[model samples]
Target chain A: MPKMPEGTVMQRLAQLLFFSALMVFAGYFSDSPAYQLLESGQTELKLVVRHSGNIIGECRALDTGEIAALAPNMRRPMVCPREKAPMRVELDLNNKREFTETITPSGLHDDGVLALFRKFTLDSGDLILHLRITENPDAGGLPRDYEKQFQVDAHSTLIVEYTDSGFSSWQPQHSPRPRL
Target chain B: MKVEAFLDRFFPAGSNPLYQLGAVSFFLFWIIAVTGLYLFIFFETSITGAYQSVESITHEQFYIGGIMRSLHRYASALLALSVTIHLIKELGMKRFQGPRWFSWVSGVPLIWLLFASSLGGYWLVWDEKAQYIALTTAALFDYLPIVVEPMAFGFLDGTTVSDRFFSLLIFLHVGLPLALLLGMFIHIQRISNSSTFPARGLALSLLGAMVVLSVVKPALSLGPADLNRPVQTVQVDWFYMNVFPLISETGAGAAWVILLGITIALLLVPLIFRGVPKPIAIVDPDYCNGCSWCFADCPYDAIYMKPHEKLANHLQSVVVADKCVGCGICAGACPTATPFKSVNNAYSGINLADENNAAILVRTQEQIRQHPQADKHVLVVGCAHGPQIDQLASDVVTPLTLECVGQLPPSYLDYLCRKEGVDSVLLTGCAPGNCFHRLGVELQEARLAHEREPHLRFKDVHVKVTTLWAGAGGETTVARAVAQLQQDERIADAKDA
Candidate 1:
């Protein structure tokens, strides 16, 4: 190996000091000064839609001529369209509308569930929250509505998810956050 | 560039931290892996037990456990530093241009993996910092259309963040780095004989620094994770978690845009700054004789052996132009590149088309005749990337700069000694460990020592030749060596009188 001029002794000492200082400083300030991720009293609101919208077209009886056009194994008395209807969702707080959206179902045949998500920021304390979700919007969908009066700033974040029974509300986090 | 020179002054070339940035990063990864394994021995991969288990290890077995944790985190930070610097330095040097674009493009994903793997390890701690990482990471991921269900839904409450979540975290923290290691391996696939380990002394110094830091101040967490309360202000490792703050400031959508935008820009940088591609090495079937010496010595794997085109049944070296960097190290490795009348085959089997090896010897002979009156004429051969060789010209010293020192075949050095007016030959290129052409110094030294192929076949070769690691701080060294050669010649003349 070709020996370099400065490395045998001086280089090692310098490496020790220089890298020691570098690692020291990096490890020191890696997590310092603290980051302000969110304000103490700021509230985050989210709307989640997991329920799939109903199928769009109703099944209709097929005539003898229509059945003749289909393949032997595929022939049936009635045929229902695989595509599902899109859903409409609207949110109102204290009678004032906050959000409204008509979300379409996913998948090739539009048979997938309506996976909708929306986020908003609102203030805390005594308020009325209303969330309305429509099962199917394309076919004059029925609107399911729920309303509740609660402290908006009860926790830093709040979520209203769609379930089978009705709209459910609670402090989603483990402990209720203290209002500043 | 001066910073690089200053570092070379204190650190040398092969062992310098700047030059070994890539290798040092690999070394740091090994340190993180070992320490991670030791921590896993005592870790519990469950939500309820994870934090408690880590705390116990930190306090009860603080000596081994705490130090390992500290080493794991610190080494990871160092790895990030080294990798980032390595990428920037290579970018500045335009090492990503031409045939090197593959290595450059392949490196883009390594940054993503570095962040992903480090962030995953934070989640394993189940601390406030982990909560922050998980929340921010999910926020960024949730914006993508592929994820129909929001990822933050699981961490919404006490019941949602399950044991399975911790299991996934452990898998990611372990699996992602293994993937990164594989990616690092792929990044060097084009360059043959790439070293993942730095020099012994350098690696030892790096390890020593990490150990000392771990001893001074061990790593600590920001308390257990509590989803019920908001973590307003938290301490986060700036290296891996920098994207989090951006996600917080700019909504997840914009953050995705910025992140992906930067990544795409990096992947396209080579094309943006690409210069006219240098010519690649070309092979001559007539002089090749299928020796395979160049094929074995090519750093970029650009040379291959195939059947000769015109010959009835013989093999010859072939150049894969797409993979060649035109460094001319292959020319130096060619056995046919000799200056002797019997072995005089100036055009080697595999040599850089841009450089005429035949003219190099003629130039040397002409330069030697210019200094015929000088009693001790030293022919100083230098690399283009090496010291400022043009400045070393004088009455007694004749300087010759090649595209690389490797472009000058060993036979040229041998031939210079037997020339009428030339007293001695001095060969210098990149530093001992740092060769712009990767293997120039090693191959040249090997050939001179008669260890590798195409040996310098001249009697008393050592007396006639002087090889030095004359790079950045090497001009003085080269000049001093020339003066010494003259001084030795004078002493010999006196003894003869």
Candidate 2:
């Protein structure tokens, strides 16, 4: 309930003016061409891998006797790796190769513990995308090779994978954005 | 001079715009929230429609939708700036120490929450920059133990981004702000009389400025996101996106480490450094009537009213020891703390430690005796901070300094100017709008003006009040006022002769 002293009302007015000026300064200074550029839209495409097949080592049949010797009452899985395999991935957009990269498996040099991490961005639109991935590389080259094609739009992300049945692609559907 | 003092010169304490940064942030949040709701009405969450929907809102409804969109964006940026400045000011003033730890600790997470919410907002646009923010934020999240799947995978090659994912994004954009509001509430819970809204004039001016900015330069979205092309350069809002560049330079994992490290360090600060220690207010149940005056006046919510069995008053005063900042304003508000009142116990009501309590009275007495026989006997009451009235070379005035001008009961004004035979009372303290104790000068002013409780009873006595808004230069202003008062008194005496 305390009243402001003499001249305080004027002081408060001056403070408001100062702050309004600051807001004006900040807004104009920040809303430059660069900010305008950020505000506008652009075409972009992002690609990522979920379970990359780029193997780091050779995938070989597991020996049940060897697994049993290592651990009692143990059964060996069908797929085992002597070494980690290198996952080689290639991307072609509009029939033009835009990116190619190799990812190594995560665990052990690849006793079949394949862990591949790969991400890349490309142009967006109604474009054809040719993706190829090799699970394991032999002495000659990648023996497990998979390929697929996709048509995508701007601002879209495509997940490419090399699976047991060959290459596959999936584009997740977006939910309706909630309105107030 | 410290930045506080420099800024205080322009923004005095009684009611300054700078004093309302917290309130301004709250105001900006409301603005952002309301505008965001409007923008959301026409927004699309799908990767395909998100861009089109925002564009429609922009070009299709330029006058309303476009302006609202721009306001949402700009107000959000302003909110960030307001909060950062608020944090820095709190740090610079060392308000983060001591019992203020709750607010400081609570505030650290609010910043991250704000950033997270902002990122969600960007993603809703589904533009190139939104894409960039989405990818980087997912990459950053992937570094944490909680992330089982790299959220970045959702946007890869347009294959995994789903309606459910976009729904989560929308939820984040909406939900996190609510969380931030809750955090803000907790941040101010321990403080009494916290302003959740800025002054009406200040609020209106801020709204006007934002509207002008929105009309002048509307917010635009970056080009639609195309995963085939990497984001190169775009206009970035430095407030929310400053750390993005740092993340780009240092990699997501390193960025996470750096940010987490800083947050942890700041949270630990209140624990590591204790602020200056002071005596806590002691409550005397015998003398306390539980009138709640002290409870109402305590700037810090340190005192509480508790049920008392013996006294006729059902509730008595209790001081939460750690929460008390020992400003002694509570003592000043307590009726029993007045020295002039006859009390059964000297340690009655809420009192500071004896030494400090006795010192206040002794100091006032000694200072008043300095110029008793002067041509015009004058008592100058000022705050412990700002220009020191005691240091002034004036024969006509005696200066009494209090921890805060508000810490002196209204009765003191009557006792000094009337009973003590002083011709005039000159009240001075921090400049307009800048009381060190927040409401010290304000409370004192109201008491002297008889607008509040504990009114200054001697209405006929001459009492002059001035704010030392100029810091050190306030000394001259005080001296000149004293000389003028003396001269005015001499003239009146001569007329009587």
Candidate 3:
């Protein structure tokens, strides 16, 4: 067997030691308590909506000439809404409601845009999430409402969004951010 | 400097036994498997029992449980580290090129399989890290079009948590490792005598280190997972869980893109800058003496001895062309491969086609002997893959380049020193363990030592012989050795006077 220089061997051993030490430091010692807590097992579900539902009985198609008559810079939405709806969310586990919230639509706003946002701490198990939005509850016999059910497990965040097509769900496929 | 040179400097002979990163990974896997099996025996897979079972293992069975847990975790982290190193080392050494694509390609999926196994193992613990992984993995799965409902629903509230879900986690924890083991087997299928384990000393040292780390800071859980409340604090094993943070920064789509892009890039690397394929070794039955020397020395297991009724010797060596790496080690191993001798139709039983032949060796030796210098005349034989032999001062030394130094039979050294009247011979090759042909340098060492068959006879030869591990950067070392041989020869002549 060819002999390796002793100095070179010692130098390499030092390098290996340094690398292992670096990994150990990064794994255990590189975080604050608060930041570590956020990354722990805590499951925070953040829900935000950017748009209100746009459900129309019928939408009229506008010609280019009609748009020119209005003004070059003026823009009109293609869909016409009868009434804006208040959003309601209910969290059910084993057929029992754990959380329920009613988000009323804005009365004075022309678009009746009601921005809904909520955060919840979910337990571990099967969960049924029911979402309903009524444009105008008093205008008709029953409220003009759209409802959908979502099921979520523990340590997960489910984002329920109100879009033009009713409720679109978004859940982070990863844990919460590093709050630290 | 070449990557081989860098490795040679660090892992000197015997100290770097089976130091290939892939083999290190295999050793780490064994450690994890053994420790994991010990831990699993005491583990409870039920949702309610999972946390308590682990706590019992840690608190009640502190010595065994704590140590095992730490070993499992550290070994897992080390496995991940070693696999990454293996990938980088192969990339640097150009081991992914040409016919060597199978191992490289299979290795990509093998990494994912390993990750999946580790992820499942974490989830089985049902600790804070397990909870985090479960939730994060669930969310990530929900992002895919294949998942209709968030798998996270099962973990949402304790009311919905069931033994079946816990069983699934346990199943995956067990199943993924089995799959990883299978994938590993496939990864090295194309390689002959592929070392899947590190040396005993290195393995024991690594095991000892992990054990010490375990005892020093036993792998503690981040408290038991509470479904009603979020976990307050925990230390993350960034090695396996780093992807979650990445997914946190970039949405799952982009994360998938980054992952898939890296995988695709790795898979396609062999196709880029591919060199022209070398011809495989072929067997000539008529010349084969059924010595089985080639069969024993073939690095790729491409040769086998078979019984043939037609020949004077019933056993003849055969070359499996598909498996042959065309390293030409077999041709050098054959006793009948004295291609330089003035014989009719000189050839070896198993020889590489076109790339290396007996004719080339005979021709090259003839050219080297064309010089008229009689005293202190030396022949410097070196590997083509290493430093070029031609770069030596050609006045005193004639250069002979072989595909690898191992491909030159020990008799070739005898022929040069005895018949060719060369005063001395200096043989140099790539440093040991860094042989591009895997076992070339090792075989050469064994042959020169006369510890193996087809040994060179040193009868009537008083020529000074030296072997050097002069890689591409070792030209100065080779030159110095040659000059010393000449100096010694001159001293011998003066003593005679």
Candidate 4:
């Protein structure tokens, strides 16, 4: 059972004031006193891997009897593997391996592109970065490697994007302290 | 719970925030929707124009569009606070158990929806904070098994993201709330006469407070999001973006575990607090003439009318046992529960499996007959959920406690006053605005006022029926009301003399 209160005019006004004060206070700080999203003191290295490795097998012309053996729709003059070769990627800083991954192509037949995006925190200093990609190992495609050196600072971002043809790198400066 | 009771001293008349948390949240949603609509009028849903557009709204159009933007953000924060607190309060009260599990479970998805919508809203700004949110959210999703292509590829900063992606973000940010509104509608589906909006004054006060807060501290965006330049320290709205730091510093994998873990735990709340199930209402089809009163009165939507097996072409009330909380409001609505039934051991059309009105009537008859003789015989019928009333039983008054006062049929008053010669009946139950069974107090009040079915046949009874509702600590209040009732009856008798 609830005891009914007198609910005087003074009490109502006092409550309204109290509620308004509380609401305003909560509403203000609810999103106010905005905080930093991440602490400073480390550089962010984002390695974006986007590539379509070489096809698994070389295409070869069919012999006359082999061509006749194929079904009508499949009777193309040449035969090739439908799948792409797996790609292996590695990253090293100052000759020490920082990350390594073996990425498989997408799709049921594994005939699509290989992509792996990752971010690694690095200490702020001048250092060498080594990126290596090995594709079509079974089909004799040689490994490709690239290296760069830079004087990095806290909160700097070094994006290393790789493609089938080659690599592109960019180092964007960080805001002085923190941006609001 | 004690904190809520402390509010009675100030907000007792009409403005209890704790009582109106759900309704207050509805009010805040309305604020968000209206302000969001206003902001959308000037918003350009493109990545290039997104950040600049919001900046223009904040600085260029400071009065109209600017204030609307601030209100939108602030109201959302308030909504999150309101919703989280509401969940906590309901959990403390263990409202997730029993038939209420449906409501509790339905609300679980709404939390996720709220988070998703807020996340999308942040992305639309295309600021540094947006960059942080988009990347972290993408990283979290990338860990899930469903991602064939990495989800984070589209969010690799300025070079990869497309304008069309902004279109999608705006669509979800604007559209997901529609799903939330639908979920909210479903949440209160089982409850009858629900007030989604709060009292007018409270609504205005809350809106006024938000308006003031918006003017006090307008929301602003951080530097434009740069992918090449990774997000460092950026000011974040703590309410919506509390986990961004964790996602940024502790790894997305850890954040994934905690978020999913909390959601799973919330979903299992009812099971965690599951108590012995309450007895469900049972129907006696033979006595039921398909009146449909019980079907109409059931608060949980636990009763449905089906074709009577015994009576030709007549509808009979059937109870859905799983949904029934056994409040017995349906039994009170049953015409067969009328005290006028002459048949020995007669059953009501619908009744709690363990107790019936006939049994209550027999007990009440014995109590009234055994009471000490006096000029006036007053009986107090209360419920188990309300204040202790056994102390009120003495020479002048008799007390009868039922599972719920609503289980007492309206005509029971007529029976006590006419056949049993009781002077008056005072019906009591859970507090005025709060009923453990949701609709018990309201339904009982309606039946007494002759507004609903099973109306009291008080014409020839000459009995005074009064009602006073109090909660667990309200014994003093009930005693005062009882004393007032005695004084009123004596004065009436003196005037008649």
Q: What is the lDDT of residue B419 in candidate 2?
A: 53
Q: Output the number of the lDDT-best candidate.
A: 4
Chain B TM-scores across candidates? 0.92, 0.90, 0.91, 0.88
Estimate the TM-score for candidate 1.
Answer: 0.87
Those runs of model 1 whose alpha carbons end farther than 4 Å from true positions after fitting are A1-13, A63-66, A92-101, A118-124, A134-144, A152-156, A173-180, B289-292, B304-316, B343-347, B366-378, B388-399, B423-428, B449-497
Better of 2 and 3 by DockQ: 2
Off by over 4 Å in 2: A1-20, A28-180, B1-15, B342-348, B354-359, B370-372, B375-377, B393-396, B431-433, B462-497
DockQ of each: 0.34, 0.16, 0.10, 0.34
Task: Please provide, for model 1 over B1-497, each residue's C-alpha lDDT reduced to its tens digit, 9 standing for 90 to 100.
Answer: 44666667677656777877888898989999999999988888888778888888787888889889998999888888888888887887678889999999999999999988988888998888988787778788878767756787777656678888788788888899999999999999999888889999888877887777888888887778877555667896888787788888788999989889999999999999888888788887777778788888888888878888877678888888889988888888877877675755465676677666776677777877777787777888888777777787887788998767777688777677775557788888777666777888888888888898887888474337788766755777777778888899899889999
In Å, residue A131's CA in model 1 sits off its true spot by 2.9
Ranking by TM-score: 1, 4, 2, 3
Per-prediction TM-score = 0.87, 0.78, 0.76, 0.85
Off by over 4 Å in 3: A1-43, A46-180, B1-12, B230-234, B307-313, B339-342, B459-463, B492-497
* Candidates, ranked, DockQ: 1, 4, 2, 3
Give a tens-digit lDDT track for model 3, residues B1-497.
35445545555464453246677788888888998898889888887677777777877888888899877888888888778777886787677765677778999998888889988887776766676677667667756654433466566544557767778877888888999999998888876777777766566666777777778777766656555445545556666777776665566677788888999999999898466676777777767788888888887777877896458647888887667767788888888776445664347676778744567567656766677665688888888666666877465688887777777777777766777678888888777666777778888888878887666778345545678877666777787888898899899899999
Per residue, candidate 4 scores C-alpha lDDT tens digits across B167-234 of 88889987899999999999988776677898787788777776776677777788888776777666
Worst 10 residues of 3 chain B by lDDT: B10-19
TM-score of 3: 0.76
